[model samples]
Target chain A: MSTIIPFGPQHPVLPEPLHLKITLKDEIVTDAIPMLGYVHRGLETLVSIKDLDQMVQVVERVCGICSCIHAHTYCMCVEGILGIEIPKRAEFLRIIWSELHRMHSHLLWLGLLADAFGMESLFMHCWRIRERVMDVMEATAGNRVIISINKVGGVRRDLSPDQLRWIAQVLDELERELDAIKPVLTNDYTVKKRTVGVGVLTKEQAYELGAVGPTLRGSGVAQDVRMTGYGAYKFIDFEPVVEKDGDSYARTMVRFRELYQAIDIVRQLIRKLPDGELSVKVKAAKPEGEIVCRSEQPRGELLYYVKGNGSKFLERVRIRTPTFANVPPLLAMLPGIEMADVPVVALSIDPCISCTER
Target chain B: MGFFTKLLETSRVKSPWIVHFDCGSCNGCDIEILACLTPIYDVERFGILNIGNPKHADILIVSGTVNHRNAKVLRNVYDQMPEPRAVIAIGACGTSGGIFREAYNVVGGVDKVIPVDVYVPGCPAKPEAIIDGVVLALGKLKEQRTAKDTDSLAAELHQAREFYANRADRQVVE
Candidate 1:
């Protein structure tokens, strides 16, 4: 006999509140349907009430884990609308912060994945190394974690030459730790047993369903928005990391490789950082235009559609988060997996429910 | 080690498996709790496991300010956990709704729905503070089980209800 088990909106394995209505024939998931819209905060509606400055804070709150990315996108959108040219130095700083966040976010996800597999020691190790990045963020920015350093036109804070040297030192230290983590994460038999071929999303399926970040990269798609050269990315040369396996291990590899790329991007920004004002002073005024801005968040590609109507407040703001785009791919991969692997599969895309619902 | 000594060690330190419950938080403390599990603090060395199921869990680590919509769900989760379960309320929002206290929808704190054994206390508390709070909860668990009768579950629930009712005025200032 087959049973339908509802996993989430309230369940243990889910890191986020994802309602997976799984049709199980014994222990295998024959069919899985995901139901979302739980954390939806009507951010689009709220955007109408907030001014451009306040909107930065509001948008930053969109995804707590990925707030820096959201804020950066919002700033980019607003800057595009106002036709204000940000300083070259500010652009470099943005790239540095964004990549730092990416490294930490991916490492954080890796730790959670380790924890989920019952690898307690590895979980601890990943988290311990992540703190070094957090310390770098704290020292440069007033706040340690959130690092609310992004503002309109450019960054709110500047990284001094001394600070740049400290950041370089930290990344170098992190590279050593990441080297140690790689063998345990990739070559370990236990991690291999849990992850390899656990969740399989084909290349065609990934494209059809619009998977983003490492999820798409894992499935052999070479799509990354950083390739578009937005902000300081044009100055910092790098390549979008890709893997063709389309399995849980592939997703893991994509994240691991991206961490290295993030480090490389930061190092390039530090070496090429121009000396100038970090933020361009913008007089508060209404923008009379509609602009669509897209930036790559840690999870995937995020699109922000902002409609301005000659007012300080935006007429309408629509943010299509990476998780929202990845949902279709998440559901497509679930039908053929064992019920126990559901959480690991869901997390492979780094499901950010807060971003999706908001 | 003798069986009695091993049993005593386990009892004194009921290494609780925590399952994170977010009634709806700003995600501040959620990340901080994750930080606690990371390498720097490594809450797992203390035998704390952040599990998924409420049935197998010995502790409920709830983040975020509770809202009217999720209050019933929070109570349901608390009810699902096995006996001698402890609730560690992490973050200012989880403890007293933090900045969201003034919001019309927020229910103020997790303790409004369930009895919280320890409050970590931060805008989103630091990772170190989260570790300390869990350690405190483990100690409190010893106090909870050694003296209380199994029949006091209903009574304890009643006390929690009364506390929540009185806690209405204790809401954080906007």
Candidate 2:
């Protein structure tokens, strides 16, 4: 007999509300239906209320975890429409903050994953290492989570040489600490027991369901939006970390490896820092065209479609957060797993409901 | 307060077990709530345990605004908790709906549904502010058993108790 379990609008392991209707045959999941919109704030429609310039603050709040990138993408879209040329130095600065934000996001996800699997001590250690990156962000950007540095033309703040040196030192410290914890997460008997081969999405299955970020990379797709080189990726070397096994463990490994990639990208951007004016003056312009912007968020590809009239307020602002794209794959993966592993598998996608619902 | 009630209040104020509800919040407040549990913020130093179930929770830490769908669920979670419960609204959204205030779906703040004992207002309240808010909730917990919000729900719960008592008396007479 198959029993239906309403897993969550709230669960201990989950931070946001992503409800699941799981049909179980004995200990195994027979099917799962995901329900969203517990966090549908109707933020997109607010574009008309908030002007294009003020919308950066609104977009940053779309998902606090990936706040910097959301603001960056929105600004990039506006810049694209206005055809404003941002300085080279500003691009480097944007990459520095954005990649640092990526590290914070991944570390947070790793810690949450550990917590979900009941590895309380491991969770503590992951979050502890994560704080080092947050310290750098808070020191430079003035806020730990949401770094409001991006403007339509360029970034607001410029880093001093001394500050750059401090960031480098912090990066070294972060890498050293991260290396120590990698073994426990990768080779630990317990983490493996829970994550290895838990939620297997074949490479083809992943593509068809429109999985993004680590979820897509875990299934062996070498498709990272960074490769297209928006912001600073054109100047810096970039590559997507790929693992072909396509299971929960594979997904975890993809995120872990990307941490190193993000660190490397930061290093490259720092080395190639150019001397130029921070921003170009705007001519009191409003966006008069529609444009779509795509950038790599901590989760995956975040796309924004902005339609602006000659007025200060935009006609429409539509966001397709990575979690929204990745969620359908959960249904494909959940059917065969043990009922006990549902939360772990669900979390493996690193679902951000606020991003999706917004 | 009676001797036993005072003792209960003292103990409850000392070790507050919190059940965090997300409602319709962006992940900001929720992550900071988790950060409080981590080594840096270490909210556990104050003996605040982050629990899953409402029945065991002493403090309700809500991080989001109430939307149409989850409002009832939020109220249900609050009602299920034992007396001496404290609700700490942990972000600007939880307090006044923040940036999402004017959005069609938002119903303003967490206080719109249940009485918020302490409102820690940050776009996504900082970990330090969240810790302070929880500490402030301890003061409120000392004063009352559960929230004495002037709501129909509280009156209904009170009337149900009286209705059960009267029914028992009528049964005895019959």
Candidate 3:
């Protein structure tokens, strides 16, 4: 006679105000518990009334699908607290708009995990190829979806060789319409009977509940903060896409192999296209201390910190994000699942619950 | 049985579903309403769907800009959807409360709380105008299943507050 439901701070396949609580016994889940301060948006008290250029639009409004990795990690923590340089063609157009906002946020989390298992044609073929990478990030950053195109001392949009040969001919029509929906989403036998080996998450419970992205690369850690090279992911070159099982179809084959490793790092960032000046001016003044940057967002490792202190404003800012380190590995993969696989194992850890209640 | 209820009404007319709901802007129409459902505007060949409870939706989109702390969770997600539901709303900050129209923590649009039917404006409303506002909310869900007495969420919120108080008393008569 366990009982105790509570689902969310509001409930109905959730709309943020998280609250979990679970403990069923009848419907199965015997334990679950979560609760976060429903959108505690004081956002570290607007870093003392904004300044590092309006605190880069309050760290790209925390997370509209990782707002360009929180304005490119608050311009890499105010260019590592004002040392500023960044310009190898605005760090490869901020790694082609942060891997085209990580292949449109892992095809908008595989079309909300195919509209949460009800599949509706693989959720309209993964949001119709994430609208050709949100129309190549709204025709090269003029805002089609917060393409504020990260700025401070770099990136605010450039790519022209006729927009990198129309983004390599829309990456060969988005790799032939993402290879005609990868056999209805990775060999569809009803998406492998609703994500095979369901929600498991192990590699020592994803490194003791700190799983991030592809649910910590589907539990086998080949961790990926773009191999910590930050912007222009240290002159392109890829790999980190791992998968060791830890179930939910190996975190849906590690986000379908990081969407072919973000379409092969945007085809090697449009074949190493680098000319000059994407943006580099920064002189808005008022910045003094603390840094901490980090990137890899698209549901993982976002970090930010910031601090500064001279005048125009900011004196403290903090953001952790990647769903706040993937909520203690989504409450350790929600106690042996069941109650209708607890919202597809809490949407296989793609719970950006507006980037963990901002 | 009416041809197997006309093949379960042609597979629920290609599968409508949908549910969404942000109702407090600045997530940019919640990432163009999850990029109009993902592989780049694949409105599921018109069988559009995003369902996540709301009594198995048939569309109810609503993005954001309504405030006073999410207007009672946007009128409890339009009273937990179900009946011949439709809604839509979308952006230009869920239509009207754009740039947080003089924010004091906004409460502007989302049709002041519910009764929408299809707006899909912009400042974050593209994904092919959210697949032309979900194919004009599935053609106003075929004129709301042939209207047999409809308006009720408290008589459509007292006919949208007496049509916005007679358009604010017809702008106090020109």
Candidate whose DockQ is highest: 2
TM-score of 3: 0.31
**What is the TM-score of each predicted model, taking all chains together?**
0.86, 0.94, 0.31
**What TM value does the first chain of each candidate achieve?**
0.97, 0.98, 0.39
DockQ of each: 0.24, 0.71, 0.12
Q: Score each candidate by Cα lDDT.
A: 0.81, 0.89, 0.73
Write the residue-wise lDDT of candidate 2 on A82-169 in tens digits: 8887999998898899999899999999998998889999899989999999899888888877778988888899999999989889
Ten-residue region with minimum lDDT total, candidate 3 chain A: A35-44
List clashing residue pairs in candidate 1. Answer: A12-B52, A40-A357, A127-B38, A127-B39, A128-B39, A128-B40
Best by TM-score: 2
Give the least accurate 10-residue stretch of model 2 chain B, judged by summed lDDT.
B145-154
For residues A34-130, what per-residue lDDT tens digits would candidate 1 score against the true structure? 7665454455676655688878876766677777888899888888899999999888888788888888888888887876777878877887888
Considering TM-score, where higher is better, how would the candidates rank from best to worst?
2, 1, 3
Of candidate 1 chain A, the 10-residue stretch with the lowest lDDT total is A35-44
Of 2 and 3, the candidate ranking higher by DockQ? 2
Which candidate has the highest lDDT of all?
Answer: 2
1 against 2, candidate with superior TM-score:
2
